[model samples]
Target: MASSSKWTASDIPAQSGRIAIVTGANTGLGLATAKALAGHGAHVVLAVRDTEKGKRAADEITAEHPDATVTLQSLDLGSLRSVRAAAEALKAEFPRIDLLINNAGVMYPPKQTTEDGFELAFGTNHLGHFALTGLLLENLLPVPGSRVVTVSSVGHRIQAAIHFDDLQWERSYSRVGAYGQSKLANLLFTYELQRRLDAAETIAVAAHPGLSNTELMRHLHLPSAFNPLIGLVAQSPAMGALPTLRAATDPGVRGGQYYGPGGLGETRGYPKLVGSSSQSHDLDLARRLWTVSEELTGVTFPVG
Candidate 1:
């Protein structure tokens, strides 16, 4: 990897002929990621919940890069049925997948459950991605240099716990705490998935944007007075997306490794290798989460 102090999107390797599927590609970090990949040479798929919005995003990519090959596929990460349907459609259309970027997420929303009755944050942020990845693993496993890049968050270190006893947050809930657990789960899932893919061609890596200004934060519901403060500190979506882009494209990135901003407190800066909370490294915890996730989603990885 290049020095963390200076790495940028220009460092991305040529992606000619690669097939990349990025979730939540309609806006924010996901949009920035899709644009970068499509601008390079990859055939990009914008997997989103809203086809109309997805079409607009695809159009935007093509407008920016006339030769960019972009397509839209409906995917609602909050629903297992939607995930399965999208995965099946993707498999039938494309046998080889070079990249799967799990970037869509919900943050700090009013307490609610997914269509499957999972806590909104945990369901959309972790379980949905988990099932989608498992269903799509076969398509990526056979392709050399393929990767699964999951987007975690710094929130994982902030009051985050598995809460296995109340994974659904059914008894009590703190929006911030619930979001933290979901982010932590993202890391647990990535690490365990990488372990399973250790002998396969595909690799699993994780990244975090570190406080970018984007639509994902709409649910924050902060006072209008704080908007300017947030704008001053938050980086652009393109800047926030560097860590993810690097994780997805950097050849030096290894399985189970994580990338994030290099700035102080990792709030905003260029991409670099970063560390996660100690709780994220518990092998036993990861295994347990993996088993429970399989039971919850009813989606199992092909790997043992």
Candidate 2:
């Protein structure tokens, strides 16, 4: 029994002839998002770091949808070299990208840096996607209804803000704070991108999967005593992926709009239009971050 009032994956419109690229599509919410789109008739390309896992994911999609068109492409978000290579491959293969879902990310992890010498969380979650989208912007510009959907999280509300002085967290770091900064960057990226794409047919949007059981939390550390309690409260990855699916497919969704769980505290439920923190909407901060991101990634967008 499906409730029309509640927007589920089934609510996604026909995606025939559409081409979607989902990052980190080898597992969890990314996999779920890829599956839904493939099921809806889109040609989905799983952009992942591990080609072996990516092939497995593509096989899984085809196993379920015999007629599905699924492909796997290598993408290591932690490295700018990989980002550029992946973008080149995608551009060579697909003339127009209908949906670019930046759904891959890292959560709380020990202090680390990407190959490009950026804080790991911010590098992969923000800068990586930033570079990818910019490099692929030319392909998306000609396609009507094309979108860039960046997946954020409720964690963005936690001690989050761009620390320009220490963008890489080189001075000091708290895993939680760094993770929140990355998530906040996701929204700021979206808002700034949308503003730049205002006159273009393409748009940029953001989404957050509430606390869902996913491998993305592998870095989370808690006392053994609390593991069971946390598991009991977490939502399924399928439900967690709804906001992303909605943000990607909803007809009424406007550029810069955000989607998330509709339940209390936005922990878990069906997807719906949601609001972000005031800090996430700070135009000055977004602009500055965008500029810094361009300089760091060496990728300039088609938009002004």
Candidate 3:
């Protein structure tokens, strides 16, 4: 892949007739990524948790580019029912999905459980997207030149590895630790999926938003008030979206590639190919996590 350190939104290639699904597209970096894809003439599906927000986001993007075909669909990554419904709907309507951006995520939140009784941050951040991706693999696998781009964070480096004994943090819960584990799972999932896809010769890649300022910090704000400091110094959502956008559209990119900013501490800058933590690239754990995720979500992928 070419050096994308100097690349900007204008460098994105035209995507006319392309179909893309972006989870959490109602706001922040996900919205920015969706807008970028639509700007290139892709049929953008804004998979959001809230229908009202999804519609509004779609309208806002279409307003900017009247010809930027956009659609709003409900997707609550915290719930398995929601993931299944969204995937089934996507399959029924769209014959192919050229790109799938697993861009939505949640940051640190006070200890709590999701609708499925798993830790909120881990459940939503990792398991939800994990199940969603597996459910939609059938449509994605056969699509010519299709790719699955997952959005991760530098927080992945914040945690060492998954705590198998207390995977749900039942013994004790540290918000930062749980968040790190989830983000790390994103990378693991990405790499694992890529390995599986490669074995099946399908496309799968991963990316990180670095330390961009986005609504993912909404939870981190109320409970701990840590977001203010991050916001004051963090990159804007558009800047954060660059890494994801680069991973999705850059022709030079390849499966299993990891992208991030080229700035100080990789916290912010233009998107470029980057490295990931060794744990994130661990094939054994990735495979274990995949099996665990399938059993938990009741979603089996045909690809593997």
Candidate 4:
């Protein structure tokens, strides 16, 4: 994987007439991704938690790309009902969606349960998107060449797959461990979704923004000053967005492909084709996790 991240927004394919949905688009990586997609001519849907913040982000994008059609829709990724409603609204409003970028996520936080009662990180980051994809399957499948891009994290290396026995962390839970589990679920969902997409000839891919300065760290106890060090090493939100854009728009991208930075240790660099961990790519685990996700979310993706 060479430095594919070297490509700038100019490198993105023109996206006229395409519709896209980006979760958690009010700030951080999600906002940057939606802005870039719309900048390239896609009509972007910003699925956000805070309408006010979403408006601010949407305003900024519109100011930058006057032609950028960004719509703000309320979403609480922690709640399955909200995910369903957002997807339903999109389905009724849009004839088709060419791209769905599952980019919103929560980082480490104190032990908490979602509206659905699942662990917060796992619930918001994985199950939420999992259910959203299911709800949007009909519209997504209608468009030929459509793509679903799920974002995971390098922290996926910390956990191979979730412990099924503690899917909700009923027994015991640690913040970092839960975070790792959620990230690992992202990979499993990506791999499994890719498998199903390929089997049904649908398109699904996965990516990760190397490292970036985003509010994703707000959940961390780190001081604001440490963010500068992160910025020094991390890529800008636009830079971090390359992998996602590539996954969504690159014509040559194949199902199951994963993209990330090409720099040293994949910490920061231009986006490029990158290899996932052996565990992240495990087929057996992906299959099992898919069933678990479906059962937990009570929404099976309409892959066929």
Best by lDDT: 1
TM-scores for the candidates = 0.98, 0.98, 0.94, 0.94
lDDT tens digits by residue: candidate 2, 71-119 = 9999999999999999999999998999999999999989999999999
The alpha-carbon RMSD values of the candidates against the true structure, listed in the order shown, are 1.0, 1.3, 2.1, 2.1
Give per-residue CA lDDT, model 3, range 92-191, as digits (tens).
9887788989988778888988889888877998899888888788877877778899988888988557887788899898888999999899999888
- Model 4, 59-106: lDDT tens per residue? 999999997898988999999989888888888898788888999998
lDDT of 4 at 168: 75
Candidate 1 per-residue C-alpha lDDT over 11-78 given as tens digits, one digit per residue, 9 for 90 to 100: 88889999999999999999999999999999999999999999999999999999999999999999
Instruction: Assess each prediction's global lDDT (C-alpha) against the native.
Output: 0.95, 0.94, 0.85, 0.84
Tell me the spans in candidate 1 whose CA falls farther than 4 Å from its real position: 1-3
Q: What's the CA RMSD of model 2 in angstroms?
A: 1.3
Runs off by more than 4 Å, candidate 3: 1-3, 199-201, 222-232
Q: What's the candidate order when arranged by decreasing lDDT?
A: 1, 2, 3, 4
